[model samples]
Target: MNAQREKLRMMLTSAIFAAIIGILAQVTIPLPLVPITGQTLAVGLAATILGSKYGALSALLYMLLGAVGVPVFSGMSGGMGIIVGPTGGFIVSFIISAFVIGWYIEATKATVTHAFIANVIGMFINLFMGTAWLKVAASLSWPEAFAAGFLPFLIGGVIKALLSAWLGIEIRKRLASARLLPYSSSKRTA
Candidate 1:
C-alpha cells in the first residue's frame, strides 16, 4: 500500500512537472527560426529529477498536450501545425535530449560535473536538429540557418544548463541524504 501510494505520488509529481514545462514554453523571446524559451530548463530539470523513462515520458506528455491544441508551446502556439513548423526540430530534440541527459546522468551516478556535461551535449543535439530543420523549413542557407536558429540561443542555453545542473546536483544531494536515491540498487550497471 505504501509503495503504491509512493508510486502514485511520483507519477503525479512527474505530471505536474511536465505541465510546468508546457507552461514555461509560453514564456519566450521572439526570434527568427527558433525562439528562446524556458522549456529547455524544464527538460533538463525533468531529466535530472525523474530519471530516463519518466523524464522522457514528461517531455512526451508536454508534446502531446501541445499537439492537442493546448497552446502549450512557445509563443502560445499549439496543434499539429506547431509540430511541423520551422521550429519543430527543437521540439523533437527535447525528447532525445531528455532521454540522453537522463540516461547519462543515471549512468554516471548523477555527478554534478557529469550532469553539466550531459546537458551541454543535449543542448548541442538541440542546436543541430533545430538548425537543420530550420534550414529546410525556412529555405535558409547553412550560415543563415545557424545564425537565425543556433547563435541567438547559445547564451540562454548555457545559462539554463548551468542552472539545471546546479539545481539537479542539489536535489540529488538532498535525495541521497534522505535515502531516496538508493545508490546500490538504483545504480545503472552499463
Candidate 2:
C-alpha cells in the first residue's frame, strides 16, 4: 500500500512538473533560430527538486505531450513537426539534461553549488545538441549554427543555470521539510 502510494505520488509530481514545464515554455524571448524559453529552467528545477527518475519522467512526459499535438511546447506550439524542427534538439536534450542534473544531485548533494555545476553542465549539453540539430535541420554552416544557436544563448543559459540552482535548491529544501519530497538520494527504492 505504502509503495503504491509512493509511486502514485511520484507520478503525480512528475505530471505536475511536466505541466509546469509546458507553462514555462510560453515565456519566450523569440530569437531568430531558437527562441529563448523557460523550458530549460523548468527542466533544471524539476531535476533539482525531483531527482533523477521523476525529473526525467517529467521531461519525457512534456515531450510526449508536445509530440502528440498538445501545444505544450514554446509559443504554444506542438505536433510532430515541432519535434522534428530546428529547435527539436534542445527539446530532446531536456530529458538527458534533467536526468544528468538529477543524478548528479542524487549522487552528491543538493546544495546550490552542486546544483549550479550540474545545471551548467546540462546547459552546455543542451546548447551543443541544439546547435548540432540546428546545423543539420536548417542546413547551416558550423559558424552560422553556433552564431544562431549556441553563442546567442550562452549568457542567458548561465543566468538561468544560476537561477535554477538557487531557486531549485531552496524549493527542494522546503519540499523535503514538508515531507512532500522523498529522500535526497536515490537509495530509496520504495
Candidate 3:
C-alpha cells in the first residue's frame, strides 16, 4: 500500500512538473531564430527535484502534450508542426537534459553545486542540439546557426542554470524535510 502510494505521488509530481514546463515555456524572449524561454529552467528544477526517472517522465509528458496540439509550447503553440519545426531539437533535448541532469544528481549529492554543474551540462546539450537542428531545418550554415541559435542564449542559459540549481536544491531540501519528497537516495527507489 505504501509503495503504491509513493508511486502515485511520484507520477502526480511529474505531471505537475510537466504542466510547469508548459507554463514556463510561455515566458519567451523572441529572437530571429530561436527565443529564450523558461522551459529549460523548469526542466532543471524537475530533474533536480525528482531525479532521473520521474524527471525524464515529466519532460516526455510535456513533449507529448505539445505534440498533440495542446498549446503547451512556447507562445501557446503546439502540434506536430512545431515538433518538426526548426526549434524541435531544443524541445527534444529537454528529455535528454532532464534525464542526464537527474542522473548526475542521483549519482552524486543533490547539492546546489552539483545541480548547477548538471544544469550547465544540460544547457550545453540543449544549445548544441538546438543549434544543429536549426542549421538543418532552417538551411543555414554553421556560422549562421551559431550566431542566431547559440550565441545569443549563452548568458541567459547560465543565468537560468544558476537559478534552477539554487531554487531546485532549496525546494528539494524543504520538500524532503517535510516528507513531501524523498531526498537523494530515496529518489532512486521512488
Candidate 4:
C-alpha cells in the first residue's frame, strides 16, 4: 500500500513539475538559434526538489507534451518540426540536464554547492548539444553554430545556474522542514 501511494505521489509530482516547465517555457526571448527561456531554472528546480528519477520523468513528460503538437516550447511552439529544427537539441537537452542535476544533488546530499555545480554541468551539456544540432540542422559551420547558439547564451546560462541553485536549495530546505520531501531517492543524511 505504501509503495503504491509513493508511486502515485511521484507521478503527480512529476506531472506538476512538467506543467511548470511548460509554463516557464512560454517566458522567452526569441534568439537566433536557441531562444532564452526560464526553462532551465524550472528544470533545475524540479530535479533538485524531486530527485533524479522523478525529475527526469518530469522532463520526459514535458518533451512528450511538446512532441504531440502542444505549444509547450519556447515562443509557444511545438510539434515534430520543432523537435527536428535547429533549436530542437536544446529542447532535448532539458531531460538530460534535469536528470544530471538531480543525480548530482542526490549524490552530494543535496548541498547548495553541488546543486550549483550540477546546474553548470547541465548548462554545458545544453550548449554542446544545442550547438551541434544547430550546426547540422542549419548547415552552419562550427564557429557559426557556437556564435549563434552557444556563445550568446553563456552569460545568461551562468545567471540561470546561480538562480536555479539558490532557488532549488531554498525550496529543498522548505520542503524538508515541512516534511514533504523524499518521496524520491533524496532521502539523504543531510
Reference-based TM-score of each model:
0.88, 0.96, 0.95, 0.94
Which parts of model 3 have CA positions greater than 4 angstroms off?
183-190
- Score candidate 4 by lDDT: 0.85
Tens digits of per-residue lDDT, candidate 3, 18-38, equal 999999999999987798999
Task: State the local distance difference test value for candidate 2.
Answer: 0.91
Error of 3 at 54 (Å): 0.8
Write down the worst ten-residue block by lDDT for model 2: 181-190
Tell me model 3's lDDT, rounded to 2 decimals: 0.90
* lDDT (0 to 1) per candidate: 0.81, 0.91, 0.90, 0.85
lDDT of 1 by residue, 23-124 (tens): 888888887557889999999988877777767778888888888898889988889888888888888888889888888888786766777888888888
Which candidate, 3 or 4, would have the higher TM-score against the true structure?
3
lDDT of 2 by residue, 95-172 (tens): 999999999888787789999999999999999999999999999999999999999899999999999999989888
**What is the clash count of model 4?**
0
For model 1, state the Cα shift of residue 181 in Å. Answer: 6.1
Q: Per-residue alpha-carbon lDDT of model 4 for 120-185, expressed as tens digits?
A: 998998889989998999999998999999998899898888888888888878787776665346
Off by over 4 Å in 4: none
What TM-score does candidate 3 reach?
Answer: 0.95
Off by over 4 Å in 1: 1-7, 175-190
- Candidate 1: Cα lDDT at 110: 74
lDDT of 1: 0.81
Which runs of model 2 end up more than 4 angstroms from their true locations?
184-190
